[model samples]
Target: MNRIGIPLRVGLVLVSLIWLVPYAWMVVTSVKTLPEIVAAPTAPLPAGLELGAYREVFESMPVARYFWNTTLVALGIAALQIALAVPAGYALAKLEFKGRALAFGLVLATLLVPAQVRFVPVFTLLADVGLTNTLSALILPFGVSALGTFLVRQALLSLPDSILEAARIDGASELRIVYSILPPLLVPTLVSLFLFSFVFHWNDYFWPLVMTTDDSVRTLPLGVALLREQGTGVRWHIVMAGNVLLSAPVLALFALAQKQLLNAVAASTS
Candidate 1:
């Protein structure tokens, strides 16, 4: 068993390295001079490492504006999603009502429908409301999340019913029970949902691209796409640098929350 495990571990390590190769290459290429990048496109190491590409990227585009736009929009969407999803999830999990099953089924059915299929209608609605060319256009459409509602519902369902019943017996109103009892127990679920919402809104590009024509309202992903388009004849080093910069904060967020996310999953399952 030990001998077989040794080979299995070695193979897994090799596969992991293969998956990380592209990201490693992007970082190395971002620091390499144009000539060096062209000279050895497949080289594992950067030649004459420098920060010139990053400097060029910042100089050539409104990176700060893009960062701010992404941050504000993503944070707003995350806060709104959590606020809506938590109460709805708690109701679905705990409150008894006629048609509860039907309501939940309908919600689950929506998960089968791709958001792309609704894009045209959503765009038309935003345009009709005269929200086109504004940040509100980007933020409003994503204000509520069905996926968050479902995930939190599942997490809440996994909690002990006796605890909720005891709280109710102690003269706790439904709202108070949720605030005092459920909220503390559901921290793991909340953290997981927050991370999901943050990442989704942070990386969203298609809706932002379609809704806003103004450069001031563009997010990081759209900004990176614009950089590639406008930097014609320039080396791709700048583009890579922009991508690296755009991805850094998200990477940091995931790294910081990874432990909480895992614990949340474990707690829900337990």
Candidate 2:
């Protein structure tokens, strides 16, 4: 047991360090002077920290506006996904009705369908409705998350039905039970879902790129890409700085919600 444990611990540590390498490089490069970056592009350490790249990144683009747009879109998507996922998940997991298996199977089937496959039709629909180049276009298309619904359903399945029955017996309506009674029990799962949705949308580049033709409603990823394309050639330091800006919120969110995320993993696995 000791031998196995020791090797496992070492492997985990090594994997963790490997995972951190890109983030470390991003941080290091973001603060490197242009001269230093040009001279030693592969240097693991910066001779001196230069914060000019961040300032240049801000000067080069409307980062604040993009940040605002991303925040609104990401939060909106997460909230909407939770609102849709919870009840659908509950119905699928708890309530037995006609075609429930078929409905659930459809949700599973959606998991196999890539977003790219549906983008053209969705884009056309949004275009017909005159919703193109707007935040609505970004938020509406992602209103239902198949993966989120599946996760919530799986999480609900692990929970006993006695809780739902008890609530119903006490005159709690289904809506009330879902919103109030079960939320506390499902905080971990919901938080996990929220974080996943937020992060996924926050870093989303493809949807926005394909949807919006103007920068006025663009998000941070687009802003970063525009920053990369600024000047005659790519500016590594400024681009890395944009990446740093993009990554900061996610890191902060993980730090704040890590406990719940861990609980979600444990609950899901158990």
Estimated TM-score for each candidate: 0.87, 0.86
- Give lDDT: candidate 1, residue 68: 95
Note the Cα lDDT for every prediction shown: 0.82, 0.89
Tens digits of per-residue lDDT for model 2, 33-92:
898988999988999879999999988888999999999999999999999999999999
Each model's total of backbone clashes: 0, 0
Question: On a 0 to 100 scale, what is the lDDT of residue 82 in model 2?
Answer: 92
Query: Where in model 1 is the C-alpha error above 4 Å?
Result: 1-6, 160-173, 260-270
Name the weakest run of 10 consecutive residues (lDDT summed) in model 1: 261-270
Residue pairs that clash (backbone atoms under 3 angstroms), model 1 = none
Candidate 1: C-alpha RMSD to true structure equals 2.8
Q: Model 1 over residues 157-186: C-alpha lDDT tens digits? A: 888889888888998988787666776887
Model 2 RMSD in Å is 2.9
lDDT of 1 at 116: 79
